[model samples]
Target: MVTSNDLLIKQRSVIKFLAAEGCSAANIHAKMKTVYGEMCISDCAVRKWVRIFKGEDPREIILRDRKRSGSPLSALVTAHQEKVDCMIRANRRVKQKEIANAVGISKERVHHIITTVLGYLKVSARWVPRQLTVEMKAQRKDMCTQLLELSTVCPRMY
Candidate 1:
């Protein structure tokens, strides 16, 4: 089935053609229901388009969709990011819903926190480990170097 967007595009094209043919708004709206079936463009929309075509140069009018402010990002889970991280660290197998329920936030917000701020993704339905901080990397390097020095000093241990 054609989506609402696709139907709008189709209706706009029809409106352009009807306008070029010098058809009235009422005429266009009347034909719309029969031509487009249940997805017919509303008469109010037809009237609006009629006004647009009448007052403005149709050729220069941009057919692009108007910009819209989409749904706002809810970051209620952000304060809980560290807590969630700790929980996951304690048990990587814990479910997102469980965490959300435990923390009292939407699972989607929890998901955003886990994947974005924490930089984690499910590996086999389990979150991938967060990236190590610079200090952690440095400490690990020093530990490996000390282990190498010890191995050299006591060769038999290798």
Candidate 2:
């Protein structure tokens, strides 16, 4: 599959070739739109690349995107997930904010890990697994049976 980066490089190559042939940015952009259709780069981007190719030395032209500076968008590594799971197991009533602080991730990430990754749901202010074990299911059945027996033995006072 052609990834976005590959598509970008392809567009840059075309832009460089056309620029070298002295084609105007407007003409290059029009041709690119016809070939790439909806996936074509913006006209402004085409113009910018054309300018760079025309002004810079051929050897100095960069076809790849530059490195960006900022904190990563996600902290969903296995280590962080394991830490959050351990924290939740240790304290069923743990809050997302507390987990975020302890795990050094955002509260939203902690919530996503708990609900989506770990398959947990909040019940009575505690995090519980979404699926119950066979033993747990049997225990719940027994409890319900006992409650029914008691209800039959002692009818409602009203």
**Top lDDT model:** 2
Candidate 2, residues 1-158: lDDT per residue as tens digits?
Answer: 99999999999999999999999999999999999999999999998898789885454579987889977655558898899989999999999999999888999988889999998999999999999979999999999998888888887931
Over the stretch 111-154, how does candidate 1's per-residue lDDT look in tens digits?
A: 88888878887888787767888999999999999999999999
Residue 25 in candidate 1, Cα distance off native in Å: 0.5
Model 2 root-mean-square deviation: 5.6
Best of the candidates, TM-score: 2
lDDT of 2: 0.90
The superposed Cα distance between candidate 1 and the true structure at residue 8, in angstroms, equals 0.6
| Candidate 1, residue 130: lDDT | 70
Clashing pairs in 1: none
- Cα displacement (Å) at residue 99, model 1: 18
Native RMSD of candidate 1 (Å)? 9.9
